[model samples]
Target: MTEPILPRIRPEIAALAPYKQGRQAGPDAFKLSSNENPFDPLPSVVSALQSATPINRYPDAAATRLRERLASRYGVGSDQVHVASGSVAILYQLVQAVASVGDEVIYAWRSFEAYPGLPLVAGATGIPVPLTEDSRHDLDAMADAVTERTRAILVCTPNNPTGPIVTSAEFEAFVARVPADVLIILDEAYAEFVTAEDAVDGLAERVYEQHPNVVVLRTFSKAYGLAGLRVGYAIGHTAVLNAARATGIPLSVTAAAETAALASLDAEAELLQRVAVLVERRTTVIAALRAQGWDVPDSQANFVWLPTGERTDEVAAVFLDADIVVRPFSGDGIRISVGEHESVEKVLQAAQSVVERRQ
Candidate 1:
């Protein structure tokens, strides 16, 4: 018999690799690779989850209650709020809605690990502008990269894997340069963790009011500790969000997730207290690493970026030896999440070792 021919696949899709999450750590090791909130879910969230037991039934495809709650909180009309499994799910929906084939999507290089891949899935080219020396989005360069084919732009504030935020002034000036028609996504997954006075608060600034093309993406994962539930929302004009909704899979946001998200909002004060503690831990970690001569970036998120360069793997090994797992970006650097307070000393010890090894 003749060998069967392989099914046809899109060359771009074939070339793309699946998204890899941070490595899981052994029981004895501190898993600091994923930037997850170290605290457990609040009692209210747990209680809410327990109550959402109608798993035999499909979730409300529209997620109306959660959407309404978020709408009331953000002071937007219900239509302006779109709910999804996570902020990342909303990213995919928005990209699919706006881009295809020869279109181009621009975002900062080494920002969110997901940004580059998102465009490829939409059959669009990804324009990754390099970050500045300080590991922040070079908005001027990104603005300059836009072309007639550019359909959307992703701005990951407190950029993931390299924690530095795009400031409000910089964002406003950059927005001024871009054409009015292009879609601008403010990816604020870590917004609650941000303590910097100058950091851009997309919702607070009401970006969409002035720039109808802009959408604010936020999540219950990082701050609300709802990572397992995978619920998030986007705020934008109803027309823009309706386009995204058209591309999305129905009933993607589960009832458990919606319930947990509402509970999280109810316990916002307590959850923020947890965020404050993590912020303090992050400050301590950054200070200790800098004192050890590491060129760590000023992180407003729950993680720190160490530009280990060629020694990325070597330094990561040092961390592993100390029973602390970190996310290393091959030749670029390492991203260590601010985990348990107990893990802080271990992180500093590992950093000190890497420093001594270089000497």
Candidate 2:
């Protein structure tokens, strides 16, 4: 019998490795890898989910109600919002909507881990601009990297892995330099944890009002303690929102997730208070880490980064041995999520022991 022939696939798709999430080894272990909110979901949100009926039925395709709520909260019209399973899903859809074969997408290197893959999946070139020495987005360098083929640019404020925000002034100047036709995606997944006075405020509100090509993505996962529920939304010009919505899978977001997200918005004040506590814990941890002579950055997110280089593996191993799971970035650093006081203490103890042993 003749051998069966297989169809050829896109080269980029074949070359990509699956994205690995942070390690969570045991039920008892404190997971400080995913930068998730350590708090439990609000009582009201839980109640809303419990009371949700006919979950067997499909969710609204457009997620009209949740979009309306988000629109009102963000001071935008419902038509300008697009809801999805998560911010990542919205990102993928946005990329697909705008980018095509031979097009280029630019973002800061060592930012969100998912960013590099988004462009690859969309059949576009992924151009990662190296971050500044402080591990912040070098907006001028990113702008200079743009070519005629560039289709989109992604900016992750209070950036992932190394957490520092792009100030409002910096963002304004960068936006002025970019071409209007090139879409700018502002990923604000950690916006709630930011304490910087000059940090970009209501970026979606400002972008949607003034810049037609600017899109802001937000999530209910981080500050809202809804990571498990997986609800996120994007705000942009109505045209761009519609295009992103077009690329999304129908009913990708569940009815229960929508219910929880809506309820979370109602409980926003309480959730933000918890975020404040995490920020305070982050401050304490950073100071302690610096006192111990570790090279750390000024983090604006709910995580701390250690630029451990070749020692990243060692540091992660120490935490794992202490039953604290921290995220280790290859050849870069380790990111430890700020949990509650107890978890933070465990991390501190593990870090102290690791530093002492290394010395």
Candidate 3:
């Protein structure tokens, strides 16, 4: 049988590779590919999920209660909070609402793997400004990349895959340079992991309220260990969030997810203590990597960036062979998430092997 010639797919999308998530690990393998919380769910979260009522009914389409809880926690109004299936879904909504054909969404290259696709899905051009050699966002260059056709700017703090954050002072200056009309999304998916003294805390900075065009995207997937629930939120101006809301899938947040999120918030102190442990583990991993002659970046997130450069794929295979899973960006680097304590030793062992082979 002959295949149909005109699938009529958009040429740009047709040529694009589908977004690749971190590789799943086998039974005996330690999965450190995704920057996910390593801890098991809090007792409170499990209790909430088990106690969820009316599973047959549709969730509150607006996630109203969760929004109110988050707004109060973040010191914002409920109208300013937007919760969705996940932060990625929020990103699509924001992009679709703000960008269209010929419009542009600008973000740093080697940042979040998801940012590029959001614009493509929205029929907007994606302008990926290169990250600095040190694997940090070049905000000055990013600000300069903005043009009349640019509709949005995505800023990923403690940027995914690469762990460095945009400092508070740097971000404030960069925001000052961006036009107030363009949407600025501060994707802080890994915010809870950042222990740095100088990183920009978008929620704490009150940039969402101070800058009408800015929005902050956060997720329960990372620090809260609720990745399986797919609940995340955005804090923005009421009007701006409404535009995103218009583009979202209705009733995307499930009752189970809503319940888990509320419970997680109730257990915030305990969860953050786990975050502190991961922070300490990350520090040790970075130190070990450096001592092994690998020039790894200081990661504020729950992952370390290994600039394997041209040997990225080769280095990734080494870790895989060691029964360790890690995310590899071909021709660029690998992102190794901080995982179980045993996994840390395995990661360091692999790093040592890689360094020895290179030397």
Please give each candidate's TM-score: 0.98, 0.96, 0.98
Writing each residue's lDDT as its tens digit, candidate 3 over 148-267 gives 999999999888888999999999999999999999999999999888899999898888877999999999999999999899999989999999999999989998999999999999
The TM-score obtained by model 3 is 0.98
lDDT values for all models:
0.92, 0.89, 0.92
* 2 against 3, candidate with superior lDDT: 3
Please give the lDDT score for candidate 3.
0.92
* Stretches of candidate 1 exceeding 4 Å from the true structure: 1-4
Kindly list the per-residue Cα lDDT of model 2 for residues 229-300, writing each as its tens digit.
Answer: 898988889999889988999889888989998888888899999999999999999999888778789999
Report the C-alpha lDDT of model 1 over 213-267, residue by residue, as the tens digit.
9999999989899988899999999999999999999989999999899889899
Check candidate 2 and list the clashing pairs. none
Report the number of the highest-lDDT candidate: 1
Worst 10 residues of 3 by lDDT: 51-60
